[model samples]
Target: MRENPTASADRDTPPTEWSVDVPETAAGDGGSDVRTSNDRLLEQYRRRSRKKSAVIVVIAALLVAVWGYAVVTGPIPVSLSETVSVLSGTDTGTAYQVIWNIRLPRIVAAVGAGAGLAVAGAVLQSVLRNPLASPYTLGISQGAAFGAAFSIVVLGTGTTSGSGPILSVIDPYLTSVSAFTGALTSTTAIYLVAKYKRATPETLILTGIALAALYTAGTTSLEYFATNTELAALVYWKFGDVSGTTWRFNALLWFVVAAVTVYFTRRAWAYTVLNAGDETARSLGVPVERTRLFGMVFASFVTAVVVALFGIIGFVGLVVPHIVRRLIGGEERILIPASTVAGAALLLSADTVARTIISPIVLPVGIVTSFVGVPLFLYLILRGREYW
Candidate 1:
């Protein structure tokens, strides 16, 4: 009877099937959601990269446009069609002479000098980790100035012809050599201090100030004893000009600039990592002291060459990098090249204005830059903490 009851109960309870409902997320939908999120993020990164590339491309285009404008612009008039014709060798007239011999060289010189100095400034700011560091502020230009002044006064390498707003140098080569010598000397001193004495950036900056003062005093002493013509010539040379630059000179300057640009751009990562701090950079296998010293040497070399060839063009090395950094952020890879192009454009624009601003008077390019740079520099200083 018991067996019959148990069997009947089991049969009645029966046939109950157990089932579990799995969530959709547990069915791998969560992984799919994750992949979708990753895809979206990758697309966003690509878009940003494309935008940044486009910006650099746009800046390059603007530089080309400025170059074209500069080529056609001058005391002598040349139309766009004529410029193209001249370039194509189809037209060999007065426009050709002016554009080919006069304006083109000067413009090209401006471009090379601007790019060189600007890139140098960028490197200095990064490696030295000083916002105020530049060829000018660091006394390199002043050192070059003293060299040129000494050449003019002591070495008797300077001579002037043509009076009243006209300047001619009898021996630009000798002057340039002396200027380079002086600049290198200054670089050597700085390097020695940085290497052996282990001077901090602040101390080096003070050294620059002292060197600047010493050089300025030396220049002044030379100027005090100079004849009036020599004085005028010295003043004119210090005014920073690209006028009368030859194709040969431009070739040399451009070659140096291109080499330096390649070097600096390739080392962008080093400079960028250096910005994290010297100790951090050293930890990352970057030679902190060596990088700083060599950077100064190369930067000073470029500055000396530019200054020797074109005179003391302040603010290009000092201001253009700061301006470019503000536009593109401090990523040295992009910053260096952008500063190169922007510097060329800015100096060319300033040179153009200098040519046209006072008409026949033809102000010094340095003066125009100073007029623009001083105000811009002040403004940048006021707001620089945001970027630098």
Candidate 2:
């Protein structure tokens, strides 16, 4: 019988890269090279893991240093022991009051906001698969701004004294309530629009841009029709002040930050699998849509709480996570935790500069973060576009 030409040609063609190879070892064991290759890859991962751990430790140390600087800093420099004394309730008088009543709360709020925003940014970036998605970058802050403005100008949630958005003696957070509602409203609206349009990770960018513009217009309209008192209230609140933070507010924010961070970290492995592509993730048994939805909601919740407490601070999200990624690489296990620490450090440093830069006249931390972030983000884009 004549040989089949098609079978001959098929046999003649070289095997594809997907072809399996099972080589025998000198000891007669099969597939030793494959095992060796996998072993080598695992070793590489281990080395990288150790280095990542070291980097996190260093960043954590830096965060502690920055926190310390924030504490003892101000017009009257405080000693570490003095700070400890006030914290321990052993100290008394002027030093104690300044550190305890004012400085401590401010420091706590800055750390909480920075850490929360940064972690939120990291989660959003991972889940959305977009390098630029963050509360501030994607209009969460604008939504929050509108919400807060509505409370102050539309709902007349401004303090009864009518000077500003200060808490009344009886109602410590009349304005805060409306702001939270506004934030959640913004989050839900954006999520729904994106979902209705069947937005991919990429198309959601447009969703954010459109919503930001709409919210900004709403805020502007509110401002235009406001009374003088309401306008001043709205204006100051929009500046993103942490100085107004009470201990009660700080406790609430810290609790949210802790809860969200833990939740995100626990899901880091799923997020890592997701980076391989949704189909690959599904093959690995990941619940792609549900995880994405939960992540967005939780991240938005964290951002909303921080925004409500601190006004509309930005950039900690946009800048910190990117920097952490560049320094450490994309594995979410490291990225999430390290970003949290770096974020706290970066914001505390920024807050320090904001307080002292134009001495006796503190600028809003939001402005400072913008100044710091814009230049840095520009540099990153220009210099390391490949990294993204």
Each model's C-alpha lDDT?
0.80, 0.78
* The candidate that achieves the highest lDDT relative to the unseen native structure: 1
Candidate 1 per-residue lDDT, tens place, 146-189, comes to 88778778888756666454345446677777877888777777
Query: Listing every candidate in turn, what is its Cα RMSD in Å to the true structure after a full C-alpha superposition?
Result: 11.6, 5.8
Please report, as a residue range, the 10-residue window in candidate 1 with the lowest summed lDDT. Answer: 21-30
| Prediction 2 global C-alpha lDDT | 0.78
**After aligning candidate 1 to the native by TM-score, how far in Å is the CA of 386 from where it should be?**
2.3
Model 1 earns a TM-score of: 0.83
